[model samples]
Target: MDIIERFLKYVSYETTSNEESETTPSSDKEIVLLKELVKEMKDLGLNAFYKGGFAYGDIKSDSNKSDTIFLMAHVDTSPDASGKDVKPRIVHFDGSPIKLNENRALDPKVFESMCYHLNHDLIVTDGTTLLGGDDKAGVAIILDTVEKILKRGNYPNIKVCFSPDEEIGRGTKGIDLEYIKKDTDKIYAYTVDGGEIMGFSYENFNAASAKVIAEGVSIHPSIGKNKLINAMEVIAEFHDHLPKCRPENTEGREGFIHLVGMKGLVERAEYVYILRSFEKDELESFKNAFLESKNIINKKYNKDLITVEIRDSYKNMKEVIDKHPYTVDIVHEVYKEMNIPCVDWPIRGGTDGATLSHMGLPCPNLGTGGDNFHGVYEYLDIDEMKTMVQIITKIMDKLE
Candidate 1:
């Protein structure tokens, strides 16, 4: 199947990952796509199977090359928008505002990148749902490139993985690293999950998640004076103490603490936050600042009213990518050979590459021809998607 056809098929399944689920795949719906991908891989005569909600496939080289190149993409879409019943529309851009629905439109004024896509075809949504192009485009590119490579014959050993729950940051948690290490000689992997055509990322935020719980004593309103403490008020005070210049106010290498979600009643309150920074020390300082705020709240209440829990997610992949410079150098060389513009930029959000890089696989992220991901404004440039396929083919051919 073609890239567009495969992408449309993949998105037809509601594979939105659930962060609240305790299962491996997080959502059972993700397995639908995983099984389909595995069947497709097997039909293509590659050794393929689904394990732990992940689809794994391998194609041995016709050549005696000792090195292996692994290509990966996530199958799950973000829960930030509705992925169910996504109605994708193909429109030719003439540089005007493209109406998605009565209330929403894709405007060149709002998304300046549409200006560059004038006269090009784009895959978009109906404004009620996200297009799921973020990593589905990546999946399509990898699958299409691999199929083409097999037909031509004579390529290095290639491994492909379609992971689940990437949107929830658990994509690599269920990956079989032992299988990866044993199948390949020297593995060099890249995740085709970056946005835009030319943009590539090796640097990503040092990420950590924080959960704060506020405890309070609830009593009848008539007798509440000086005897009752409102947990909602305590939680509000905690948020007020947080830095005003947050994620929205900061950009380009500046880190910020983001309040993602909050829930509470009078008896107890909970706040979920994510801390992001390029530097580990800066991330630590930000985390400490939150703890200090908690300390102040505890002192003010004269009791341990607020408790904080912090957990590390992933670090910048540059630390690992820098060790093996060729991993990135070869990609730049491949882009130069293909006359594709290479844009090196820091990823404001984390990717599967960061987690895998930290897991002993020196992986960086490659572009996927997607824009405005994780929202209704998401789109995929058809021409750029085709170019991404070419780029992947070239990388496979050039891999030693």
Candidate 2:
């Protein structure tokens, strides 16, 4: 199948990962797509395997190159939106408002990125669910490239992995360099999970998460006075106490603390926050903001009513990528040869590349020609997706 055909097929699976689940894939539905990927890889004549939540595909090269290039994309969509029963259709985006449904429209005025997509064929979602183009597009590109390269023959050694729970930041849990390294002194890995056509990132946010729980005294509102401490009210006030460094208020290297999930009542409340920054120190301060707010709120209530738990996630890969310049050097040589202007985009979010780099792989990130990921408004530029195939294929052809 073509790239677009494969993408649409993969997104049809409801692979929404559960952050609450402690399992490796976090959701059983993720396995449906993972299993299908393994079958497809085997059909393509690549030695493939499916174990746990991870899928691996190996392409043998006739050329005995010293370097083994690894390409990766995640099968699971983001939990922030519904990935079930996705209804996708291709639209020829003009410079006018494109209707998603009766109530929603893809207007260039609202989403400025739409302006760039004029005269382009885009695969978009219905107003109800996300299109799942974020990494599905990445998946299709890798698999399609695998097929094309094998047919072309005499290609460099290529390895591909499709992971689960990437949106929840658990994609790299079972993935390591040993399997992909196989008889090569140097490994060049790239995570094909970035957004936008020009996005090539070597850096991403240092990330962590904080879960806050507040306990309060409940009373009948009619008979309530100072004795009544609403847990919901306490949680809201605790949020207010922190600096206004929120996702909406920050951009482009300016870190933010974002509230991802919340549930509460008068007697008990819980909220989860994702803290991010380009700098380690800044991320530390962001984590501290949660503790500091918990203390202030607890002190204000004169009770130990608030409790917080913070856990560290992946760090920025720039520190490690800098140590191995060859990881990015090949990308530069390929883009220069292809005459595509290099776009050094820094990811405000994290990727599998982040954790994989620290795990000794030194992986970088590449764009999948997608935009507005993890939402109903997400889309994939069909032409750009095809361009990505060319870009990756060229990189493989040029690999020494």
Candidate 3:
């Protein structure tokens, strides 16, 4: 199938991952797309399998090429918005807002990036759901590139993986690194799961998550004075103690503590926070700040009212990619040769590559021509998607 056809088919699966589930995929629906991708790979004459909610496949090089490249893209969409019954539409841009329905429209004025896509065909949603182009576009590009290379009969060995629960930061958690190493001799890898056409990322935030529990003594209102403590008030106080210039107020290289989830009653309350920073020391500082707030809350209550536990999620990939600069240089050279401008920017959020790189993969990230990922404004520039396919093919050619 062509890139557009493949992309549209993949998005029709409604593979939105759940962060609250305990299964390997976090949602059974993800397996639907995983199985289809495995079948597609096999039909194309490549070795493929669906294992543990992940789709894995490989195509051998027809030529005597020793270097193996691994391409990865997640099959799951973010749960932040509805992914069910997504109605995608194709529209030609004329430098104006594209109306999805009477109630909603994709405004270039709000999303200035749309200006760059003028005169290009775009795949968009109906404004009620996300388009899932973030990584589905990546999936189509990898599949299309592999098909083209195989038809031509000369290329480096290529391995493809479609992971699940990437939107929840667990995409690579279940992947067996030892098995991958035993299966192929990997020289380089990249996640085709970034935003924008020319934008590539090696640097991402050092991430961690924290859960805070606030305990309170609940009593009747008549006897509440000096006898009862409100957990909701304590939770609010905890939040207030956090830096005012936090995630929403900061940008570019600056890190902050973002409260993602909160639920509680008067007797008990819980808050989930994601802490991020570009530097490890800075991330540590942010953690300390939270700890200090927790300390103050405990002291104010004169009891252990607030308790917090923090866990590391992933580190910056640049720390690993820098060791193998040639991996990035190759992509840059290919982009230059294809006359595509290369934009290297720090990823404000994490990708599967971030965790995979730390696990001895030395993987970086490449763009999939997606914009406004994880929301209703998401879109894919068809022209840019085609360009990415060409870029991948050229990278493989250079490897040969």
lDDT of 3 by residue, 1-400 (tens): 8999999998898999998899999999999899999999998888999888889988777898977888999999999988888889999999989998888888999889888788999999999999999789989999999989898888888888989999987999789666556556547689999777688889899999999999999999798999999998998999888876577799988988899999999999999999999999988987887899999999988899999999998899999999988789999999888788888989998888989889988888988888998888889999999998988888888884
Q: How accurate is candidate 1 locally (lDDT)?
A: 0.89
The candidate that achieves the highest TM-score relative to the unseen native structure: 3
- Clash number for every model? 0, 0, 0
CA-lDDT, candidates in order: 0.89, 0.87, 0.88
Cα lDDT of model 1 by residue, 75-171, tens digit: 8999999999999999999899999999999999999987767888999999999999978998899888888888898889989999999899898
Model 2 per-residue lDDT tens digits across residues 269-355: 999998999999998888788889999998888899999999987799999999999878888888888888788889887778888
Candidate 2, which ten residues in sequence have the lowest lDDT sum? 176-185
How good is model 3 by TM-score?
A: 0.90
CA displacement after TM-score superposition, residue 212 of candidate 2 (Å):
6.6
| Each candidate: RMSD | 2.8, 3.6, 2.6
lDDT of 2 at 103: 89
Task: TM-score winner between 1 and 2, please give it.
Answer: 1
**TM-scores of the candidates in the order shown:** 0.88, 0.84, 0.90
State residue 192's C-alpha deviation in candidate 2, in Å: 0.9
Evaluate residue 14 in candidate 1 and report its C-alpha lDDT on the 0 to 100 scale.
Answer: 90
Q: In model 1, which runs have C-alpha deviations exceeding 4 angstroms?
A: 213-242, 262-271, 294-307
